[model samples]
Each structure stands twice: as C-alpha cells, then as structure tokens.
Target: MANGTGEPAEYEIYAIRYGTNETRLRGRNFILDARPDDPLTMDFFCWFLRCGDRVIVVDTGMNPVKAKKHGHTMLLDPVATLRDFGVEPERVETVLITHMHYDHTGHLDAFPNARFHMQAEEMAYVTGPWMGRRWFRHAYEVDEICRMVQLLHEGRVDLHGRDRAIADGVSVHWVGGHCAGQEIVRVRTARGWVVLASDALHYYEEYERGIPFAVAFNVSDMIAAHDRIRELADSDDHVVPAHDPRVAAIYPSAGVGFEGRVHRVDLPPRLP
Candidate 1:
C-alpha cells in the first residue's frame, strides 16, 4: 500500500505513465541555473487513488498527438496506461484535475462514470483570461474546456476554488502559481501525510532550490505553492513530485521499469 497507515487496509496509489520525454521548455529564467543538475526529463503520469474498490484519478495524462505538440517527448496512450495498471477507464468514478493544463486534463471522456473536480478559478481563467493572451495560448483544448463547462452545467462537475475535504483522508487545497485555479491533492496515510504536488512542484529541485516551474502564471504564488506543498506534506519526505523521472528510480517498480512504479509513502527513503 502507498500509505503505511496500520489500518487493516491501505490506500493504493498507482503511478500510471501516459508518456515520457525531455523538455527544454521547463528550463526557463534562472530555475535551470539554480538546479544545474536538474534533467529535462518529463514523465507524464495520472495518479490513481484506490481506497477499497473505489478509484479516483488525480490527473488524466493526455492523448499522444496533442501531447507531442505541447513539448512532450513521447506520449503514451492513456487508455493503454490505465489497462496496464489494472484500472478500467469506464469504472473511474471521480477525477480530480489538479489544473487545466493540456497534458493533465486530456483523457476525461475515457472515464465513463467519472465526475470531475476542478477549481472554479481555472474555468474562469481558461474561459475568459487565457483565451485572449498569447502566453496563455494552447494551455488546453478549448473544446475540452467546453466539455468541462458542459459538465458543470449538467451538475456533474464539482468546482472547489477553495480548500476543502473531498473525502475521508483526502482533501483539495487551492495553490495558485502555475495557473489561477491550480490545486494539490493531500491525503492522510497510515505512515503520516502524503501530498501529491501535481505540477505545483514538478520536480524536487523546484523545492530544494526554491526554483519554480517556468510555465507559471504567478512566480511568487508559485514559490508560495512550493512552500505550501511542504506544509501539506507535514514534512519534506512526504511530498511527491509529479513529473520527476527520479520517482521510478527510487520506488520499487511494480512491473517493468516504468510500469507499476508505485511511490509508497510507507517505504524507506529513496532520495538523498
């Protein structure tokens, strides 16, 4: 189990890979200089939170072709990735999109029973502010945003622009930096605290050196978001960086090299 809580049962956290690539775009300003050894590796993954038979997805890794256009080195098929993880896309009930980035919110329609959770500010930014600016351009698919808007209209989408608990041991906190409504998923495990810093701190270097992602909308807020990730983790060790390839290296690979690589919170330290 991912969380080491001594309960008879534990939450299963699966790192489903959607793609991988080297990205120079993530290196910007002084962030790369601050962490000179930081690699340009990008691991596109959608996290699965399994508590009992219930399945919740943290983010949906995108469709291949579209993902490639967005600077992803190699795009893995989301459907294929889900199947490899023993999850059926149609059975996913809840999908929490950490933000509205094209790579993170790509394959929503694949999950038939899923009701999405997103921040209200994200919707407004994508709909009103981002659409007008060149810098914010291609952040997402307008049609996909429209689909989310429709889901909101149909009452199938939950908008939480504020911090709130979504379920037992699981909560969503608004941490704006990369995007207006960007949030992180925090969960309490038997081990202690486990915080998924989905793009909030894309890699360990972002926090270790106080460097932020280059694609941020607000730099100070992004720095605060990085600090907030530590606070939510309740410790430096409990926070998980979403795209760091180091994760697969540190954690036990459940299957092949990248496949079944689960970051277990209850496990021993895999980082320096």
Candidate 2:
C-alpha cells in the first residue's frame, strides 16, 4: 500500500460495535445448513478507516428507533461513537455504505457533509419493482431509503458499478448476494489488506463452512461471494466479518474506554 510518493500509506482500521440481536438460531442464520437449531447472536458494527488525515466510515448503522423496532439492543449511538473516537460527523469526507439494508442505512442523515459511496445497483434495487415484495424488502427501512433518495437528489451520493478506490489505501468491491448492491471493503493496513466482509459474509463460519445467510436475495451469489472476499483480502485471516460477536471478543481493543465494543482491526487478532 503506497501513496503517489511511493511511501507506505497504510491506514488504521477500527471496528465499532453498536448493537446486537440474540434471537437468531442456526436454522434462521444459515440457509444451507441442515443442523439443529442452535442459538446464535448477531452483533452490529460500522468500521472506521484512517490514513494520516483522511477519514472514511463504513455504514451508518441502525438508529435507536429502528433497533427497537427489530428488538436489537443498542449499545452505543454510531454518531456519538465516531465523535468519541475523534471524528466528527460534520467533517467526514466520505462514507462507504455497504448496502441499503435498514440496519446499514438507518442514520445516514447524520453524515450530511460527506459523499456517500454506494453501488448503483443498490440504489436501483431499493427503488425498483423487486422491493414491492415483502421478503426482498424485509431488511430495508423505507424512511432511510427515502433519505438516500433525497441525498442522491442533493448530489451527496456517489454511485458506481463493480468497484472503486475510495482512498489511497482503501477500496470497495461489489459482491451482490445478500442484496442486489451488497459490497465489501478492502483496506490496506500496516499488517495487510483487510477485507471488511460487511453483510456479504456476516459470520466468519459462513464462509469457512461454505454456507449462505438465510436472509439473502440470491443464494448462489452469496455462496460465490466467499471467493470474492478471499480475492480481495491478502489472506483469510485478514478478512473481518461484521456481525460475528467473536470479532469483539478476540480482537484487541482499539484504545482506552472502548474495550469490548471497539477494537483495532489493523492489528493481528489474538487467537487462542
């Protein structure tokens, strides 16, 4: 990861956990798994990327109202957490919205000053006829979707196809499976290229076991995305799953006061 000057331009990455849903079961989470209904807990997170002065955020995360509606335990406000992490919402220059799912785009209004980078297909999926069916639109919030539409009208949304580089050491790649516009982030950190497998690979085991998440728009795409995540990351160990509670448990804390909730992803994971 080098800049225009040919110097190492590695960014620091942090994963900030904000909410959790503990009602999930293996029967509900893994669409391909035929195992018994074992309990599973899904945690919510939004990632932060920093290289020198450049700041980029991934996902806005679900707001209080939306979290409560879905029975998610809100641990911290995403906006507040970012502020406490020393990045203000008013100053963020770019945001990578993984998808338009309700939990991902709930608080988009908070980052009005930045250009929200998202897949063109995602914008179309949310507004297209496919969303008329309840199953396809179950994870999306109409209010947040409308807000994105408003942002598009306001010219605050940057929509593209396939993939694009967001910064010198950061890029996003498309892998539409969980949804029409699902994407994952590939970041160049000091250790290596870390692929933030947003909802495309919610749990670490999802890819390891070759299983698809149940709440998906295309099962085939979901299964195929496992390969894409590997292609983007430097190694399988560098890939970070967004919804796994194990992430917060094993990864070292980012800094003081953020223990158990925020951890530094650029550092190597503490394996047993």
Runs with alpha carbons beyond 4 Å of true place in candidate 1: 1-9, 23-26, 29-39, 256-269
Candidate that scores best on TM-score: 2
Evaluated at residue 201, the lDDT of candidate 1 is 76
Collision pairs in model 2 = none
Per-residue accuracy of model 1 over 55-141 as CA lDDT, tens digit each: 678888876667667667544566676677778988888889998888887777887678889888888888885678878755778
- Residues 1-272 of candidate 2 have per-residue lDDT tens digits of 46546886888888989999888788888765666478899999988898877789999888889899988899988889898978999899899999988888887878778999999999999999999999999899888899899999999999988899887778889899999999999998889999999999899998888888888999899999999998889888898998999899888998888898899988999887
Off by over 4 Å in 2: 1-6
Cα error of candidate 1 at position 149, Å: 1.3
Clashing residue pairs found in predicted model 1: 5-190, 5-191, 254-260
Error of 2 at 236 (Å): 0.8
Question: Would you list the C-alpha lDDT of every candidate in the order shown?
Answer: 0.74, 0.89
